[model samples]
Target: MDLSTLMLLCVFAFTAGLVDAIAGGGGLIQTPAALVLLPQYPVATIIATIKLPSFTGTGLAIGQYIRRVRLHFPTAVLMCITAFGAAFAGSALLTMVSSRFMKPVIFFILAGVAVYTYTKKNFGEHTTKPYSRKKQLWYAFLISLVIGFYDGFIGPGAGSFLILAFIALLGYDFLHASANAKLVNMATNSGSIALFLLKGTILWSVALPMAVCNGLGGIIGARLAIAKGNHFIRLFFLCIVTATLLRLAYDVFVKN
Candidate 1:
């Protein structure tokens, strides 16, 4: 890649990290940016390359969240493990099936999420356990398995879906949900990146510098979300979800 193209990818990665840290739609930005930047590469290669920057940024965000926000360690760990395994399996599935069939389904699901979140004013505002510890763990496992697979196979708004699931199923507030989502997302991204590396699919030349910028953006965005608190995160979450829904709609309905 040329210096200009590398810089552009880093810029997009930074933007993606910033948005992703707050609301979890970074792939909506980074994936398209990668497609534009590396048009010659296969779609899977671009997806794999994007995971490197995303994983780096998410790792930083997870660290910041662990330090500042309270985390449910047991649930988080269970979900992380489930997500790791599920994502690896999903990555393996990517070699067998095309993801195009999944796009419309995901688009509809994101639309439902947007509508549900919009209509419910106080959703994700306060933390309260709707389920017992064991039940919550079970729910977490299910969520990690489904969404982590989606993340590895055809990621766009996986983080948004995770945050919503954490809020609705576990009764976490937006801030706490976001914190847990970051850790799970980090695990999923790590699994995908490992698989991509094993397959020799990622472009290290572009990913390294972008990873640095993405990590920096993650730090800034995480701190900002911490300072702003739950209300801000909730609003940002809605916006990102809406944007993601629209983007997916365009891709599924208009682009193809």
Candidate 2:
């Protein structure tokens, strides 16, 4: 890549990591930017290269979140295990199938999520009524499997979806949900990265520099979220979801 192009990608990577650390739609920024800038590369290679930066960013965010939030270890562990496997399956499927069909479906879902979150003023502000441990585990498994698959397959907004699931299904507050989401997100990213490595699709020269910039952004963003708390996160979530909705709309209606 030329110096100017590399610099532009680094800027986008940092922005993506910052946004993603706070709300989980970093791919909205990073993936599209890479695809647009690095048109010479195969689409799969661009996607795979981006995953390394994503994984590193999520890792940094997790480190910050862990120190501030109380995570449910049992639930998180179950979710991570399921998510990893599901992500691997999903990534494998991506090589065989067109993901165009999923865009409209996800767009609608995100719309509903944005509306519900907006109208329900207290949503995710505090923990909801608790589910039994067994129920929580079951819910976590399902949420992780589905969102992890989506993460690997569709490749955007999976973190936000994970957070939404944890808050809505598992009765977690925003901070707790974000913390758990980071763990599951990390697992999903790792699963996809592993597959890409085996397939020899990633361009490490691009991914490595992006990863450093992304990680720095992740650290700052996570700390900001922790300091700002639920209201800030809720607003950030809405903005990210809105952006994802628009991007998907463009893809489904205009691009296609």
Top candidate on TM-score is 2
What is the C-alpha lDDT profile of model 2 across 210-237, one tens digit per residue? 9999999899989989999999999999
Instruction: Name the regions of candidate 2 deviating beyond 4 angstroms.
Output: none
How well does model 2 score by local distance difference test?
A: 0.90
CA deviation > 4 Å runs, candidate 1? none
lDDT at position 99, candidate 1: 89
Q: Candidate 1, residues 1-256: lDDT per residue as tens digits?
A: 6889889999999999988998899888888998988999998888888889999999998888889998878888898999998999899899789888898988888888988988999998776675677787789999999999988887888999999998888888888899999999999998898898899988888888899989988988899889999889988998998889889888899999
Please give each candidate's TM-score: 0.97, 0.98
Global lDDT of each candidate? 0.89, 0.90
Give the worst 10-residue stretch by lDDT in candidate 2. Answer: 125-134
Model 1 scores a TM of: 0.97
TM-score of 2: 0.98
